[model samples]
Target chain A: MPTDKFQRWVNDLQKAQPVHPDQTKQTILSAMHPKRRKWPWIVSAIAVAMIIFGVSAATLPPVQEVLAKVPVIGKLFQSAELTIVANAGKLQGVNRTQSDNGVTIKLKSAYVQGRTIGVRGVVSGIDDHATTSGRNIVYHLASKSNHLHMNKASWNLQKDHAYTFELVGNVDHLASGRKIQVPLVFTKMFGKKINLRFNLELKAGKPVKVAFKGQTSVSGYRIKVLSAENFDGGIGSLRLRVTKPVNERDYLFGISNIHINGSQKDYGLGALGKHKSTKQSGIYEFQTVALPKKISSLTFNAEVADWSKPEIYALSELPNQLKVPNRAAMYQFQPASLHDNQLEFNFTLSGTTSSDRVLQNDDLPYLMYLQLADTKREHAIVDEYDTKGIGKNRIAPILYWVESSHHFMARVDLSETPFKDKTLDELELVVPSAFEKTRKLPTITIHNQK
Target chain B: MDDIILAMHGDLPALEHLLLENADYLERTAYLYLSNDTDVQDAISDTVLQAIRGIKKLQKPQFFKTWLTKILIRQCYRRYSKRRHDPILIEELPVVPVAGNELSSEQRLDLLAGLRQLNDANRQALLMHYFNGLSILEIAQITKLSPNTIKSQLLRGKQQLRDWLGDDYFAN
Candidate 1:
């Protein structure tokens, strides 16, 4: 059987000499070489003459004025090395360190903005650093009023003596313009723990309201943007209200292609809250970055059904990876490992599904739902492992998954499903379907609050 | 291949040899992404300089080919981004035979035209897989994407190409 002439075409393309390889090599090598100096004495004389000429050229008022006019050239002349120092903002340097058993933790810089508090530093003084199964360091931010911690606040030590430490955690729960004594706590290092406290003057920004007057309904789902606010640390929030939420095994259906001032902004996981009376879910999530200071218009595009329902097949029918087209986006599902009780798979999404090319900085979370049936019993696992409300499911695909400039990659764990009890021969994977039309909401304007 | 290990230890001659040997692969890969000869030349030069400067950072010497290829691809991306608005036309190049042993001249043109319709990432993925005979995992490493993503891109690219060149030309 012919494996498609496309493969044959590609094989033939290997022999196609689009560009002369040797010619390219020669050109590159020639370009890389510095121009040769014909004579040493002449070269030295020319260098001295050029230096004298350059001095006179610099002193002349006309040259100075022309150089001044070109500020970029003037900047180049001002410094031999071009290093632009950024304004570190109002955040002060803690410059604190803790030393124990020759291991030192140095606090380099700290800043507080809106709900995000970022800290950068270095851990040094260890002669030989090893990564063992149990030898791990955990960090947390604790204050009298607020407490936040990350058990897996991991850092990798480079070839250099210092271990790079950078941490950014949201502090939206705390009040702005408040002087808070936040303690930086560390645990489980060399069988010991350490604590460093810093006095931070936290500032939280007020969010601008994003009130869309007319709600847009798509496939029985009503969506509207409630409010948007700019916060410190280049963080912004968009509060959303969704009627009749779509449930997933791991995470909720998400919104994408959020354009503010005609530019799409990456979105993080929005905090989901269900109203006690109406049961309507209000999502309070932060944008990947802050919005511009002012906006004349804002548009929100939500993914109603991003993925197709799971399609089940026998073990023999399943390829290593199955690619299915969903409108503009192509979803590829690759089975990583299958066990009696657990199934793991990786998925990739590509193509121009939205107007905005999903940037590398954007975080796209996967919500996987798994259902398995066999002769003995039927089992279903809705793995909303991405959402916080579901369980202790802290399996963030954003951490393991990659959102490349070209596509999105994610891995799913379905160990808790009923696959463990079934026979090895055949089973069913429930197809969880989602529609893929990005609904652009009506453009709206919000007045600034006094 | 020992040149990679020698180059990792700051051996300039070995590094030069390794680069000269892989020049064809780099040029072919760069040409697929970039049309302009000047950009292709510039990308190769830059890739060489970056590879030399960043060799110590290479974790494994065995992956030296893929590492060099990755740097070259990134340089192609940079060139592509800079020259996006003002694309250097393929008409500028001197005439070269597009026809191969199996593909006719018209079919070759059709294939090239179809490739132009695809995005830069997909085109590169296809060329890397079929032309260079790189596995999905190798392509994944070079593209800095998951293996699954590379497989998807290759499959999608093949489908798009088949769509353009007629289904009869690419019957399964």
Candidate 2:
């Protein structure tokens, strides 16, 4: 542990230094001026106005373009994500509270044109009496400005999603019985698009976690099963959940949209990934009766609402690999005959588009090849009836099978316990087009159909 | 206010006592950062003057050394930036007579050669730890880095120092 090379190195540095014994105490003060002082505190008083009023430094004269040219310093500043401090006008004697320190820090944009603004932080120090202006709140309109780059170049919805923040911290001075207040106004750089459910983890500090199940709208909307004839559009709700990423923070909830189409419905804040409403990957469309409002926010263009199209198919994507059982638990489904006295709805990759459809397309196969990976089981293209409407034939239920390039068919099966199994984490489904002779195609779900 | 004025003018005995205790350390700190120059004294003197003027602003006086040293370090960086040099190498230049005292041989030979090779960040970390004697936590607060980052730098700096000083020279 005691290497002499290290010790000598430490020694050499100590030896090569000098001492300044004479220059110990110094008394220095800046030139006093009245107008020079009133600018900073005044801005802090109007921080809320500044942020909501949109008076930020957006107008800075092409900051990134001009700053990109300054040799070394320009490169540094340009490449940097700037988080410079702006002056928040003054707040004098506002009946200070313990948790209000971060809020008290005055904030403002650097300039009206958006560059070179000032930020002044006001901490009330004891034995410190500011020059008596006519008003008790002697606002520091101008602040000492410092430069920072924009939010990090890589910061975005994926990695770091930054949002505006208001922080307030106050703790009492134990010795003097005076309170120490720190009112900081700064933008927080969150790595993700403020996903309260996924990113806001409960670790140590207080963080707000929010999740919602429906869109946070003034009006509460509900999803109703409409008659197939009257089916109009999808309803949406924004669901959100908030968990403490830090310890002891409060939970929050917000809505995104309500009862959107299964595919159009965006996921809540609890889970991570590209869970947005606009994503069109896995939505199953159904008929919805029109509600009172005709904003058409609910109407999507690609929806197959013609009702006359005969090739009814439930479409979903299959991942490259299927997850097998790690450790099997509980009992298997005792082999039961699929249908009995009740009408059995067949699950198929290809099927007649409507119940009234008399002729099926010969170009497309009437059934699709279905396979189970865990048990090398293969079912032939057949007509299976589906009696359970709640049953999403995502894995085993063959909603519709493509028998050929154009012909469609449906499968009829009696058993329906696959989705109800508590042990299954994921199930796989494949629908191969008959004419392709190779590629298994995908199907889109048509809801509330016979 | 008058006492503050007295302290500022260096008329107060308290100033002298503080000098006797810490002037040597901060001077060496200034020389290390400012790099054995004439202005090193002035910069250190300014650091002291600034600290004295703002001592009331210091909530934790026990950490006065690190606190004042932080101010000195900032001044050093600012001055160095003003001079437009990135990692200023002081020993390559002719020596300027330090105003107060010379460095100890143990300090001079081992630390100077080792410290010159360090980048601004590592050298600052090393000096703040051994010279100004700041803890890892305090160092983190000043450097705005996590504790582990500081520890790794210290380890790397110490290793580099050993490699340069030759075997058995600094054996402890």
Candidate 3:
């Protein structure tokens, strides 16, 4: 009843402005008629054909050589319109103009960076003061059928009905020299739609050399640093293969203490996806914070926690006790309560001692798992949305709140665990170990195929 | 869902029908986020145009509602960012009292004023939950946050409102 009351209040508030369906429908239809009727499909087809042609042409040896020589300039050649203008040595002639219903839409310039295509152009039609109309001008990056829409750029209208628009869209993470189709549809209120198709070639930058590749183990967990690339924008993409099938939890805690060129940089638990062929391992994808300087021989470090080891405690050991020490801190754990397949624990972090020092620590450091006292099934503790007052989903099993600098209270709900209502075989407490190691990865060069 | 597919194929009537179906919803969502009448109207208009333009990319027709909601939210966020430097326009709205409802006009105003006082994240969580009647997971997907985060924000926001409206306001 209380919930219903809140619902009623919300419903009442929503009624503040009663929208007239017919009037709104009429307005939308009026805006759609001039634009949606004549164009879209044909333009998209032509654009696709152009992309095929452009892509085929880019693969030639001469083109690759040219692209290699002018990497910087190639980035500036974003759109087909711009590419033509660039090749012609006339940047000013890049503008492709189309006039329909007394308005002209011009494609002034475009360029592709990676898969992202950026377009800048102008729309000149209509009164200057009437530029900010209720009717929107939509720009489709691909085609109506393919449904690629680019919404990044804003159109700033100047005096005299002249509007400058910049649009950017991505072509599904394409590589350099690949070609993509972009269908630009300009629709204004009461004006016929203007469609322009462009087959854009991706500016290929030299692939960043993979400086390191090797297999290593940390805290009993096997991991392979498949490859690491140093790309523009100070970002580095690392491909990894870990012993365990990486889950969402791995994205938050799989990697830690990452340093590049012996200098520390901000890092997150990297994303791990299923290997194309096998589920036994996953492809770990993650990027490090902006590199401080050019990388020579880089060092990689992380705490790959092994939560598989189960520390069994009998019912007689009510309120089981466990302690695990990492490099800088000792983790003290005590089971507080267990019922209905739910478990709660009190964890205390003993600060660094003279013998060991942890560079830094996470506010919440432990990942959780559970097994029924009677069954062998082990269920990972996952972030539950049903629980109220949590703004973000907890992909990791560790549910905790800091009680003090060294004290934390944690809760685990086994309802969704693998064992669910089943009797537990044992309760396992998995915590990160303090053992630390840094691996100097060997560089592996990637040869570009001719 | 069918409407979205038809609209993508350049069916004007389907497009019109789809826009009409979500017209009230768009206005309410925009109004809640922008808290300005003019901005709400503008956002709704922009949402319609953008939705139609991008309809072909809707991928799955079943996701139409969520997709449309995401678009309107983007428009509302844009309007909010643009008006951030200006003082919140808490324009006086006439009370069209709901029949049989016990909440007084002053109380309603207090609730609205309290809403305006809350931060954007908290306010949005509450509005999405209550106004849109979306599940926590749905809200999380739209906001690109974890469901737990949405739940916590919702709880904190509800508490803040309860604090302002009196603890007994929702008491059974």
Candidate 4:
């Protein structure tokens, strides 16, 4: 049959030899069953022996001291890269185990400071083929009242198909020396159900509240450190408010170089939480590392994009498509249509660099702050926009690569910003400068903390 | 079918057996999207890893091939998107083995080149429908497009291929 010939051609196409045919399966198996490290097993053995002999280990202060010094659960904290928790002085050893379906989960240690709670554990007896992404495994830690607010959790695969896990969160109404029953549940592990609960005796300490009233102005932007709370194990939360120019088009792109204790070293800020922003100012909360017991100093820099000197081009004057030069790639913007208070553009990026370099260097989307402004220079309120599946939002543009067409696609929507009822002829598309000016603000130091 | 069940129950040997059974199909399907042999191998390895990890989540064991094919396609697209800028080397093209077939080696090369020229959607639709022998509904389910859309794409893709290959090519 005619179709049979085409099928033969496709079959012939599939006869290509794989580059690493001999080692492909073995490589995959090796990844699934990584080589076991010797130290963790030794640590596990020593800790297990202590647990077997020291029945009243918690009651005995000396035994508890030894357990604290070499806790098996400490391995979980170390595996998670939470050095603060691993080196913490107040870690309490739980050393409890639950087993089902040949799988054993051991809760090793926990700590409570203020409302913050940290628990570390290990899961063993996973099949070698059960090599799923760590993201698929879900761990839920809750109390009977369900007031335990989980902040962060991580699980790392260990040798012998085992996994070390860590959980950090905040709990409400946790008093010092109060005993709480914390139930840790693994809803599904390798398609099996496993539930483990532990009765934890909480020895909570209060997190010191540091009054951070520092403000600095740089490049027409005011950055203020509102407040901060210092928790045990060098974990802290810093709240900041950045006030931008009243112009809606002007944007405070980013704030970085956050350092404390007058040290030049950057401690690296973690996830941002509780963000409230408006046209004028934005309040941000950040989880930081190595917050000192005493507040000495705090410093940071703010980057602001000043749109006062934007290059204005009329909608009629601009071409249908134009190539803009970029560092790692060339950006092509094809203006599709401008009708009914909506303007559309197809943005494509093409480059001859590695994917990582292209992804890191492609900043046209951030600099492509196209806005529709009237002759009076009043900008329109951006009502809604859709980049299809390309760009994420107006501020943060996440460009998705189109597999068929070797370029990234972004569709911009500017309908309701300055004027909802203005014609295309009466408005001009404003293009902001591609570069943001960074300014270092004066360091603010705190004094007289109890 | 027993293998699927055992694999779902965290049996490593069973999972390995299942992957080996479908290895050819996975590699071939990935080759349709990626040109590089190394990329195709990476995609296959990723498919196997993901299949082993997520086999238990497969509600219907009968759809194992379909599930594995979907994972392979995703991995192929990921590599394709990442390495799109790399120049395609002519030497890297697969050497076609001559067999007792109607189409000449030159004609086969033309067909492969024509297939590559089609857009991603049309090419995927044509390959899945004709090469993989997937029904329109199955293609729609896998591609997350409507059945009607898949049908149109298949029709358009076949027409485009016919136009490129010419009437004499298909008449053989």
Q: Candidate 4 DockQ category?
A: incorrect
Q: Is candidate 2 or candidate 3 better by lDDT?
A: 3
Best of the two (2, 4) by DockQ: 2
Give per-model TM-scores.
0.34, 0.25, 0.29, 0.35
The better candidate by TM-score, 1 or 3, is 1
In candidate 3, what fraction of native interface contacts survive? 0.12
Q: Can you list the residue pairs that collide in candidate 4?
A: A379-A418, A380-A417, A380-A418, A381-A416, A381-A417, A381-A418, A382-A417
lDDT for A343 in candidate 1 is 43
lDDT of 3 by residue, A157-213 (tens): 566777776554433232333223444444332233444443332232222535454
What are the RMSD figures for all models against the true structure?
29.8, 29.8, 26.8, 28.8
Worst 10 residues of 4 chain A by lDDT: A62-71
Off-target runs (Cα >4 Å) in candidate 2 are A1-450, B1-22, B36-39, B58-67, B77-107, B144-148, B167-172
lDDT of 1 by residue, A1-450 (tens): 224565676545544735555556564454334353235435444544564456435532220000001111101112100001113254446677777656677777665544445566677654442323212222223332222221112255655456665554543232333333444544323323444444443333333433332345555555544445554444555544455445522123355545665665533323222111122333334343456666555555444333323445543244544444344545555544455444444555555334422212121222332333343222222222211111222223221223232222322333443343544255433333332322343333233332
Candidate that scores best on DockQ = 2
Give lDDT tens digits, candidate 4, residues B1-172: 9998888888888888777766566656777877665577667767777877888898888988877787777677678667644433212322221111234554555556557645456777777777767788867766678999998887767765553333222333
Residue B58's lDDT within candidate 2 is: 59
The TM-score each candidate achieves on chain A is: 0.44, 0.14, 0.34, 0.44
Error of 3 at B51 (Å): 2.0
Tens digits of per-residue lDDT, candidate 2, A1-450, equal 334544445545545544323332221111012233345324422432353234234322111110100011111112110121111221222322221322222232111111111121232211112112111111111101111211112101111211122211111100011111222122111111110111100011111111111211111212211111110111111111112122321111122222324445422211111111111111111212122221222222221111111222222233322221221111111111223412113321222233211122111112222223343333222222122211223232322222233211233332444433222122233442222221111221222221
